[model samples]
Target: MPHTDVQMDTHDIALETPPADVFMAPSICKSDLLAGKSYSHFSPIPAHISDDMTTECVLGVDEAGRGPVLGPMVYALYYLPMELQQSLLADTHHFDDSKVLTPEVRSSLMRKLCTDGSDLHRASGWATRLLSARDISAHMLQPAQYNLNAQAMDATIDLIKEVLAKGVNVKEIYIDTIGRPEVYQKKLERIWPTIRITVAKKADSLYPVVSAASVCAKVTRDAALDVCYEPYQDTAVNEDKATEASTHVAWGSGYPSDARTSTWLKQNIDPVFGWGNECRFSWGTAKELLEGKTADVKVDWPVEDDANGDMRMTDFFAAKTEAGGDELVDWFGKRVTEEMEDF
Candidate 1:
């Protein structure tokens, strides 16, 4: 029998390099490099290359509104093939965790990802759909925390199911760790027993896929807020006169530390839309609402244009009141000058 031996190539393989014009060249001037090349001149490594190992399609998962005093918990999933991922990495060297980018840059990247070759899926648990704030308020903070966590987990599972239904082949999933790493891993494992899941402390910073998902989730949630806020802008302005004028700021990271958001909550807590039912009464803002310390303001409803070329007046009160506090000031604060009670 002839001895068979396999030989490995010792010489370095010549990798194909594109022509100078065809290849992407850094925008730095030669003079700048000669003076002293800064870190910006360094080329970024493509996301598709994962620690010298090429990975199959990877699904990135992220959530938003985790600490918000209002609104629902939003979860998003992004899937990218190795080739397209590398292409995106090569084209846009600035791609990184969404938290590191400014709002304008994040918005731009979000639009690019949605239009570019990436599959996106999102799911949410609106405050209305979950147990009412009143119900949660009936219990202590611990129970409320449990309920919110349950809601978030349910939303995440639903999002994963939606992505799977779309026929995307995802072998591995990466999540930005929420609570304790071990706890999050166990919780995710319990929720998604079939899939291989990894809970990274800062997956968004480490994994390009997770960063892309974060951008998607943040942008989608922001857009939703804009939709919810359109009708309320006029109301916000009107309320500002009676009470402290609200800054009417955009969603400020959904954290309790956001002052404008806290002020908005303080202004809106009342009977028609009290802390427990209307807002996330479980938050500290809700406690403040119950204490009656924040500003008291009400949003104004728009006048309806009827077919008879007249505005609909449901009652005498509607006919008498204006956008300003004229009626309220007269009725509540100051006594009526004349006895018009009979009307």
Candidate 2:
């Protein structure tokens, strides 16, 4: 779509909606979070699109919670008629880089976007993919499997694909990048050759669509943290203990540097388990606890399964075979013949 010039004052039209219903119920998504997975959410489709309108659309992508030691990392895509990007966002909606907006302002902007009759709601479509804390930890802790960068790339690609699958006419795409812009831009270009792509550092501040996407991703992440509760409990506990265990415990911004977050980590860490599903055990603070303070706990990595043989490193040193190659087999046989001992 051709960029349009419109004369309008920022904040000329104010909009309002009911209180935030942005977060899903803990019961609805807690299982997925506990299982260490990502879940997606699509904003309600606008009521109508003008039949005469055939403008190619533009999409922007950004993420939130990338560095958090708790909660989910959310990647969001925001798409709208290309021509209206500047006028609708900069001139009217007053969106900038979401980090610049106060929490109240971010919530307000999202509420307007969700409100049915508002121009933003009518003209825009957005989606978010929330990569849970448990899942992030699982990936990061894996031996040479997926790292945070790999997970982020997958999430970004998945979000864009999801938005396109919903049938939005996405043409030009803008992205805020965590790494080298040239590398990320080239990678995306190879995937969707026909679509124009721009990947840049701080693209959210440079492009309104990216800014809007940032707001969506940030607000959703914040709301998720706002409602986060312990996904697993051995038994039902009293409200006081339950509250002490979960949502009532405030973790400020989930950043390791935040004083509140560090304090929460120090206060709630289980000596053996470390923390609940809310924690990214692979992160330094939690990792240190397991490695430095609680090293006495016998922990196993790369658990034995149908694919991997059940051999611990200690077994090789403790047993001897004729050729040494068969020591594990002999060790197992001897263990079966005698009493087996736990590690």
Candidate 3:
């Protein structure tokens, strides 16, 4: 994939990736998220905005699907007037409807948020950054690793900057943090000196704005997962897999702990490429499945012969041949001892 440069100044928030069925879902494009690339989407700037930079609005950032092994990690931001924070989000719209995070409720809330002329839609604005499983795995698996926390922080910052640049009167910002909440909060404060930034462990459950942001992120991830299997369904390695891959029939929750997901991965993995881009190759479970003893093929990666003396498997075999050593004895690392019982 080519390096994608996001246009920050333009209101054209449509993702630059391949087109998708717009009617499918509001915040998610399955192909875009699972196409081995990361992308961002911005909701249309709310028309109920005044040009006053002094206008006080509260914004929140939250993420979803961070632990899942099969779907995109979505980072979302929501901003609305500070006065309306209670009246609009909490009371009227019920952004904090549930004591626990509920996927079903989030989906329903997201639909309302996206609906035209809805109070939630007309008064607030939002954006999302969908980090694809493939892109994430690629970064972390590379020689110079970029960890998930860093990637997440960058994505969250990008969403906030996008909203700020679009002239949102952001006065206070709240974020659901991954690790080192104080450090994250300080970093965000350094970036936006004027805005009061708050980063908490469960900011989503505590703050109404953060809860709304969580709803957007969760709904986007769930919808993306539903469509993630579409691309691989037709071109599956086997007919049985093709039948099963039709819209996540047995794909499970995309978590490594889930037996159904592990079964799906085992049954559908390609010996050469592992599973499709839906799987995060950087995850320990994925690595073990692809490279461990149970793998269908034991692939030996080619190594460069550097001046410092790098070695390949073939080099060792060749050295044994030159030494006139028995291949079986050397391969098995076995040697007979005088007192050995099983030697």
Candidate 4:
């Protein structure tokens, strides 16, 4: 595929059939606030690296759907032989310059990349961490506070660490970052002193590897968004196979600013529970709709009389013994003085 021009706004990613495989749901984040959880997938080592444990390679990292108020934020890492970085992806496949392809084109490229025995498939190894909306919203909304940036950074680092542990001779790393690139660059450098690392804004446009990673992330998130809509596709589908579901693209780009997304949120929200796990409740858009005048009933959570100070003295000593006793002295192993009679 030749490199095209301009990035589509992703408002109407017309995938006739949503790529359900990418919307993995096996793993989970441990949190009471989350209605759903996140998951990950790591591609098997490429055949090209099977024979050589120390094969020199270059890796790139990028993410998609970070700003969307709906769907998961997918962080992806793609790597291949350092020498083939330019020749194979850039020159042969034209995966260059800011992923200058349409949604269909990107999807097509990804399909080819995933095909067994394909040139790209045999040469490259990749992975993704799909952060579910419920998990993300719950984290950000938690009392301690874990924001998106920290979550993004951890996902990136986890991918790299897994690659290293798998013995993929990573020689250099390139990352597409938002906000202070130099700080991220230095942090990575400190962690992996041996590998050369570059962290920059728009690294996707500057580096072919990052561009390919961008494609992987964007395609996965788009397909996942469609999957997220499956539960709510009732109104648009017909019994006839010939009829297409109008709701396929109804959710729009999922950004808070998108008119279609705003309308969809208004139409689908539950009066009591709000939207499904696909929504990020922490976002101002979702929060406002759930608590604003549009809401059917005002919700007031009951407060405990002493939420933070409910712990009693018994809590500290409960684990020490399991004796039957109503008094504190009887709890202490039938009293030491009675035990002294045995001595």
**C-alpha lDDT score of every prediction, in listed order:** 0.48, 0.73, 0.75, 0.78
- Which model is ahead, 1 or 4, in terms of TM-score? 4
Better of 3 and 4 by TM-score: 4
User: In candidate 4, what are the lDDT values of residues 1-343, reduced to their tens digit?
Assistant: 1111112344333322234343332112324113356878788889898678778999999998887778888898999999999999999998853245666667777887788989998999888888999888888888888988899999999989998999999999999998799999998999999999999999998888999898888877777777677667766556677576444557777776666788999988888888888888888778788888878878999986886396787765553435554455675576877889988
lDDT of 2 by residue, 86-197 (tens): 9999899889887777667888888888877899988888888888888887877777668877888898899888777766677899999978999988999999999999
**lDDT string, candidate 3, 1-343, tens digits:** 2112112211211111112321244677655766767899998877566445556799998887777678788898998888888888888767862225455566667878888998888778889999998989888877888888889989998989888888788989999986999999899999999988899988887899998988777677767776786665543346665553223345656766666667888988999889877878878778888888888889787987686377777765556555687565666555555337574
Q: Which structure among the candidates has the greatest TM-score?
A: 4
Off by over 4 Å in 4: 1-35, 97-99, 235-247, 302-343
Q: Across residues 239-260, which tens digit of lDDT does each residue of candidate 1 receive?
A: 5557544334343333445554
lDDT, residue 201, candidate 1? 79
Model 2: colliding residue pairs: none
Model 4 residue 305 CA deviation in Å: 4.4
RMSD of each: 22.9, 12.1, 14.6, 8.5
Better of 1 and 4 by lDDT: 4
Candidate 2 residue runs with Cα over 4 Å from true position = 1-36, 47-53, 230-249, 293-343
Of the two candidates 2 and 3, the one with more favorable lDDT, higher being better, is 3
In model 1, what lDDT does residue 11 have? 21
